[model samples]
Target: MFFFFRKMNAVYLAAITAAFFMVACQTNPNAKKLDTGTEGTIHISVDETYQPLIDSEIKVFESLYPKAHIIPTYKPEVECFKDLLNDSARLIIVTRDFNQQERDYFKQIKITPNSLLLAWDALALVVNKANPDSALNMNQVRGIMDGTNKDRKWQLVFDNANSSTVRYIMDSINKGKPLPTNTMAAKTNPEVVDYVSKNKDAIGVIGVSWISDPNDSLSIAFTEKVSVVRLRADNGSDFVKPYQAYIGIGSYPLKRGFYFCLKEPYRGLGSGFATFLGSYEGQLIIKQFRLFPARLNVVFREANLK
Candidate 1:
């Protein structure tokens, strides 16, 4: 009888231990195996304007690390921030960093979010091939944005109403003023190009990446559909296109920084990917996309020709 009682007690304890581990696993899926820098899966959000560049980044990253999988959702910058705040995304790539309120909220939650300036991006103004006005100075650009230009009837088109490009224009160009009453909103950058291609009087605001990739057939097609508008600064004499060298030299009129905000508490896949972006290889990819790389040091030299 004593031996039988001891055996029954051992069986009960083993069952209890099994149940405890099961409950722990259910509570936290990563309890059994924690995600590391080079391994595991993560979800991230990216601004739609950066889809082309980021797609290449992810493809290379996954190929390098077969154990790591990153699922990304492309949306507007505002929506990307919403995903970061709601804990739906481990990282987000957008035009700006976290504001004061966002930093405060993360502090309150005892989470320190990381922000990295990845590259310098340019906003390209495109018009129909038949549109004769393919160049504008700062004053004319502002007038068109604010609906104050009376020289010509222009229709302004944007990728989305809440996109980062619109925000940049309102804050930097328009000086907190509202957009024009007749401004149109296309669903995506490609759609904006399409709209401008069809409307001879329309001007489309899009990211340079959409039409800058020389190797991409779609990018070449976009350039064929519309002509990129040359922009002159308020005090500058020459009109310049949004070339990578112009952006690097501060000659481009419309430029913004690309950033990544990460919410991972541990050194997980998010941190790994962010590190990769700031690495030498990653910056090379960015430069190939015709954007000025922030992490890589590039020198410009002037030559005297006869």
Candidate 2:
């Protein structure tokens, strides 16, 4: 009844530490370390945008491999990257791969990290449930980000200035234009959702996983408070929400890749966890949350837009 996708690039895999895999995995002699194996405590820095999906992934992984303890430290994407740089984090889940600057820094240190693109993620615009304005086109959203929008009543809300969501809008949508001074900042993604849920005049930018699955209790609760705005492409006429199919086919205009960067020199808990996340079971969790899974063969579907 379950469909398994192809294994991810071997760079992301680790030896299945014994007494952990109900199913077997061949041990690699070239693996990084021998002592830690598959089961051990690990601290990971994760972007708050992926807290929901990663939380689900961790729960399932821990259930299967009881000896593993993955302690996730959720923060803004920028902070997560900083954690990795200072050697405070062994693994991190974020929206992007290493930039040239980061690569150069690591190269100077003689450490080339193994980073994997795990899945596709989207930036969702949320409005109050009572608000009627629920759709935004590429130009319109760009106007809001670049402070060109004529409407003064609508205020823009963000997770954090240093967060990837803000950077994506600034770099991708605003095309390097600076944000307006009036932009609002919340501590985390849930805060953005909560703020939009209460403020009809505000548009909250958040990750799609927070509200993509209607059957999810948290999604239902978020839906009760706010509505996900439909987005139209730069040239397209029809608006599409950040649904799985929309993201899969590239219809969702604000989609980005979800990645994992591991700093383990040997096959440690960090490597094991990254392997689990990119594995079939890991990709399934991404699919269940309505994001496009990188490991699976996906067929995009079109649905009626709200």
Candidate 3:
């Protein structure tokens, strides 16, 4: 009777231990360690243009790791790189890649980042929905940004100072021509949207990701207010628009990749967040924005591939 009782007690304890671990595994892989550490702070710097998407990504990350707190700092795309070089930040999220010169500088500094390509986006040319014109060829866009075209303007085409839209248009399409002297300069994209919304002659250039994701409230709102411009091969090959579908399918002519450049190996919460953003979960967040998630396979609408 004594031996039987001891055996039953041992079996009960073993079953209890197994159940505890099973429950812990079902909750979160990090849950067991949650109480072992106190609060941790991390700083993430991102370009203003990507603030919206990066903000969303960070939110999702926090939800998964409740104890982690991240403070995000926003600056211009160029300035974000400047901060990284100065060691003021551990991470930077931006729309462009490091140029050859910048890459060489990093090599000299002995800092090679573990880069993660987050998603694919495009520079878009937008006109007021009220405008009669809805399409622009690459040459036409180039002319507007580089001042090579005389027909584009607020007085003639639409007046808006070349923001990133104009800058990218010039750099990518025209190489380096100055924007038309008559271009109007709006302080931000929203201002551009507002100006174009009210003025039929005005056109705006922006990133396709800004208005592509209908599920994202902010993106949908922008799409509802402005008209996205379409592009075509001047030889009448095909008319391409800035829809996520068109861009994903490689039909859009102005696509670019978004990247994250970290200053060094992460040490704490920043590292955790970085790993999360570069992980499968984080890439899914990118796909949710209607941009093509990179370094991970994500499915989009069938039209996106065509």
Candidate 4:
């Protein structure tokens, strides 16, 4: 009888241990995988134009969650999209969302992507500190882009031939027209800035984030290297710089959407990072980068002085 009771107790203990592990597995399905919402490692792609801002975001996120590791590949926007489509990356940060065709393809594959608008980013036109032509209207910009601006014959420089900044100029500014023969590709934003800084006649077209972070020493140095051009809207009378308030109010002429598209089927690190970007803390970081935070509500009050 003692032997029988001991055997039964051992069986019960084994069953209870098994049940406990089963419940744990059910509670955290990601335990079997390497990644979860708040833990593990993941690879993501980001547009090189937003490298500065996204770098800061990742640093903070990883610091807060020590076990979460995000490896980001910064490349052209088109390449980032390619990484997403090819499953090379679980998340991508770019200036636009998936088009209808991409959506349809994902639907066909039974994958639903989560795309969130992160912020409003602006393209900053930078010129040499010696260059006096710092302000331009919309028409003038169109002329410069299309090689029709005989007024100054300014040499146009872009970060990359396939970069979002180039696409923005072609689509939004040039109205789908081809870039002029004079437009040069500098490979990266910093190179564009460097080129423009050395060439008085060259204008570097880059994302505002490259030079917007007042707290970053590199950003401050970039700002000091070149003069950011003020842009007058097509209809507005005032020429405004790419300040956060200007971007928020649509006063900045070269503003574009910043977005994060996650292709995670589960609530993994990609989703977690995406949620963080739209959260108050993430939006605050975006604000610090000087981009207009789309997820945060900011009130602009008018104050008058006597």
* lDDT per model vs. reference: 0.91, 0.83, 0.68, 0.90
lDDT comparison, 2 vs 3, better candidate? 2
Report the Cα lDDT for residue 151, model 1: 97
Candidates, ranked, lDDT:
1, 4, 2, 3
lDDT against true structure, model 1 = 0.91
Residue-level lDDT of model 1, residues 1-306, one tens digit each, is 999999999999999999998888889856657677789999999999999899999988899999999899999999999999999998999999999999999999899999999999999999999999998999999999999999999999999999999999999999999998999999999999999999999999999988776476422233688999999987778899988888888888899999999998889999999999999988887877878899998898888989
Clashes of each: 0, 2, 9, 0
Where model 3 places Cα greater than 4 Å from the true spot, the runs are: 1-39, 151-167, 213-222, 234-236, 298-306
Candidate 1 wrongly placed segments (more than 4 Å): 1-32, 214-222, 303-306
- Report the lDDT of model 4 for residue 126: 94
- Which model, 3 or 4, shows the larger TM-score? 4
- Report how far off residue 207 is in candidate 4 (Å): 0.3
TM-score of each: 0.88, 0.83, 0.75, 0.88
- Comparing 1 and 2 by lDDT, which wins? 1
Q: Distance from true position, residue 157, model 1, in Å?
A: 0.3
RMSD of 3: 9.9
Q: What digit string (tens of lDDT, one per residue) describes model 2 on residues 255-298?
A: 99999998888888888889988899999898778778898876
Question: How well is each residue in 169-195 modelled by candidate 3, as lDDT tens digits?
Answer: 667776765555666666565666677
Which 10-residue window in model 1 sums to the lowest lDDT?
213-222
As for candidate 1, its clashing pairs are: none
